[model samples]
Target: MSKQASAAIWLWLAVAVFVLDIATKQLAEMLLVYAQPVEILPVLNFTLLYNPGAAFSFLADQSGWQRWFFTAIKLAVSIMLIVWITRLPRTLLWLPAALALILGGALGNLFDRVLFGHVIDFISVHWQNAYFPAFNLADSAISIGAVMMVVDVIRETWHDWRQRR
Candidate 1:
């Protein structure tokens, strides 16, 4: 496919993911309202939580400065990803799409932090007595994007190595 077409595909994928992430978060905020955790199954639950820090509640207990710091960092990362996506080769569709998803997810969470002082998280999973912290669609997108980028890198490296032999 042409470079323009590939970029368009990535752009659309990002838009779809962003819309889904924002909609789910809004639903969580409106319906959950800091509600008590609701168990969906033996290993899954839904709980409303607001995060003012980065992943795993990094800097969650710090003074107010960390909120702005994380917001700024997310904005910077989003900008960098957009620029990098534009420069990506047409054949690197998978990698560029992954980056776009990560960028969109970052922007979504950043928007919440800047506008609401925290990110809405509602999905929770656990194993017996052990529980994972609640998360939202935006976080999931970022995690998936990161994993896809790693796979893309490994595949590209292996292809290049084979070509050089």
Candidate 2:
């Protein structure tokens, strides 16, 4: 595909994912009470929580400095990703798409952080009573996209190595 077409596709995908993420988060906020856990299965649950910090609640207990810090970081990262995506090679659609997913997800959470001082998380999973932290669709998409990008990179490296041998 042409570079313009590739960039356009990634841009559209990012917008779609961002919209879905925001809609789902809105639904969670409307339907669930803060920190109220609702079991979906033996190993899965929904529990609303607001994260004011980065992943795993980093700096969650800080005296508010972390909030703006994370917000600024996310904003910078989102802008950088957009620029990087535009310059990406047309054949590396997977990498750009992955970056777009991460960008969209980051923006989704950043919106919450800016508007509500935290991120809205609701989906939860556990084993027995050992509960995993609550998360949302955007986080899942980012994680999946990152994993795929890593896989793609590893495969490409291996291919290059074989060709060089």
Candidate 3:
């Protein structure tokens, strides 16, 4: 088997995400009370909530089994993302960063899920009566990374098309 080049440089960003996520969640837990929203801006609020399910509180109403189920899935996915990051080529730089961010975010929440049976979410946004689900730094990093990957895909597609012309 040939030796593979690792995309380890971007792993620091992942660590940062994990650390920040944990710290912020801890602060949110300590500072905010249940069901109370602290307005930070016109559209932003810090509202502490414990989600027992996946993104957007999916399966949150399940009969308590979803906690362990989600934990297992998060572990599997986080491992897979780490493997994917290491396998990524240097030229596809954004791919590794994106995968690493997703991995870190997943692990951050996985830590909570395994220990507390829930993920702490504090950030909230709303417009009039329309409200978005509260999320944390991990979720934000994952989302930004995903968008970066999408942009990378579009850039590559355009480059390939130009080359083929």
Candidate 4:
């Protein structure tokens, strides 16, 4: 396949993830109140929240500098991830999927940070009185992508080991 076609297949997946993330954020905005959570399950809740900093509220107390910094970082990382995706053969299923997911999620939050100066987060998980940080679909995508990357690495290592043996 042509490079464009190859990129297209993966990029389309990224676009889908990006679009879905935005749509879900919009739905959360309309259906939920900011920081006021509605329980969707015993351990999960839908809540609208914004994060001005990096993951886990890192540097949130900074004097408005973190937003641009993070936006730049995400853009740089996104470019690298896209390049990684395009370089991979489509025969490598999980690797490309993982990279596309990370790229899509990065762009999704990049849009929010650039346009709105923060990310819209809604999904919340908790146990009893303990609460995990609220996150959105973009975050979920990124997390899953990271996990898939680990799986790919493990698989590759195992294959190499077997070949050597």
Candidate 5:
């Protein structure tokens, strides 16, 4: 059988995501005032914020070791994903796409953490007095990619069970 194309081709998607995330973050910073909300809807606003730690501001209050810690983790994860994507067959689209997204997002946030000492977050979601943690395009991409990966695993498991039945 002819060798199938490797999913490394999907790395382009990762590049696109990374570029877009960076562009949007820059634009948000330029257009939005820090900590000042620009309401776009009843539940959504653009409010510039910086995250020095991982999700939900975890370890943000620490003296500052978490930056390098998260940076190391992101580097490791991005490298592993690149290798895995290269080994996967292009016919397996969802998993590769998911990996690419995650790689892009990781790089985006890593760029911010290294250059600015924090991740730029501008998208705010709220319900009256309750507000969700501020996040950016990179965070959204990572979240979507993670959800896709979980769904793909569930699908594969179900397929395997059905095949055995």
Candidate 6:
């Protein structure tokens, strides 16, 4: 594809996300006490944590294999997203941006998994006696990206339906 037409141009977003995620994680590590909640609001806190497994601590109770298992998955997914982004049309905005976010988030967590054998999570949200799973900026990026993908699909489907009428 021509340089001007390559969707790879969106990769700058991925790099931005990665750098921001790493920087925030480092700050959290340096400033927050592990497993202790530093209240930011009535429903939000910064609680440093190390998640040794996938989202929601899946496979967390396992011996030690989950570390490398998740690492491999993250690495593979990052590569696939990069390739997909490259193949997309530059004119397509949302899809490429979403892919870049996911790619960046995956690499961010993969960095932690490879170096620390765990992913650092700090942001915490709770209400009364209930608590949501703690997550980091990387997770936020991935979730937002996934939501964007769903929104794009819905929009496209709606457009197609309208054209058939």
* Per-prediction TM-score: 0.91, 0.93, 0.93, 0.94, 0.97, 0.97
Candidate 1 accuracy as TM-score: 0.91
Q: After superposing candidate 6, which stretches have Cα over 4 Å from the reference?
A: 1-4
In model 3, the runs with Cα more than 4 Å from the true position are 1-4
Clashes of each: 0, 0, 0, 0, 0, 0
Enumerate residue pairs that collide in model 1: none
lDDT of 5 at 69: 97
Error of 6 at 164 (Å): 1.6
For residue 10, model 2's alpha carbon misses the true position, in angstroms, by 0.4
Which residue runs of candidate 2 sit more than 4 Å off their true CA positions? 1-6
Error of 6 at 80 (Å): 0.6
Q: 119-160, model 5: which lDDT tens digit per residue? A: 999999999989999999889989999999999999999999
Off by over 4 Å in 5: 1-3
Q: Please state the error at residue 139 of candidate 5 in Å.
A: 0.6
Per-residue CA lDDT of model 6 for 33-146, tens digit only, reads 999999999999999999998999999889989999999899999999998999998899999999999989999999999999999999999997799999999999999999
Better of 2 and 4 by lDDT: 4
Q: Encode model 3's per-residue lDDT on 29-57: one tens digit a residue.
A: 89999779999998999999999989999
What is each predicted model's overall lDDT from 0 to 1? 0.84, 0.85, 0.88, 0.89, 0.94, 0.94
Ranking by TM-score: 5, 6, 4, 3, 2, 1
Give lDDT tens digits, candidate 1, residues 1-165. Answer: 344533535767677777898898888778775858888888988889988878978877888788899989998998888878877766667888899889878988887899888888899999988888778888998999999999998999999999999
List model 2 lDDT by residue over 18-47, tens digit each: 899999999988988888888788788888
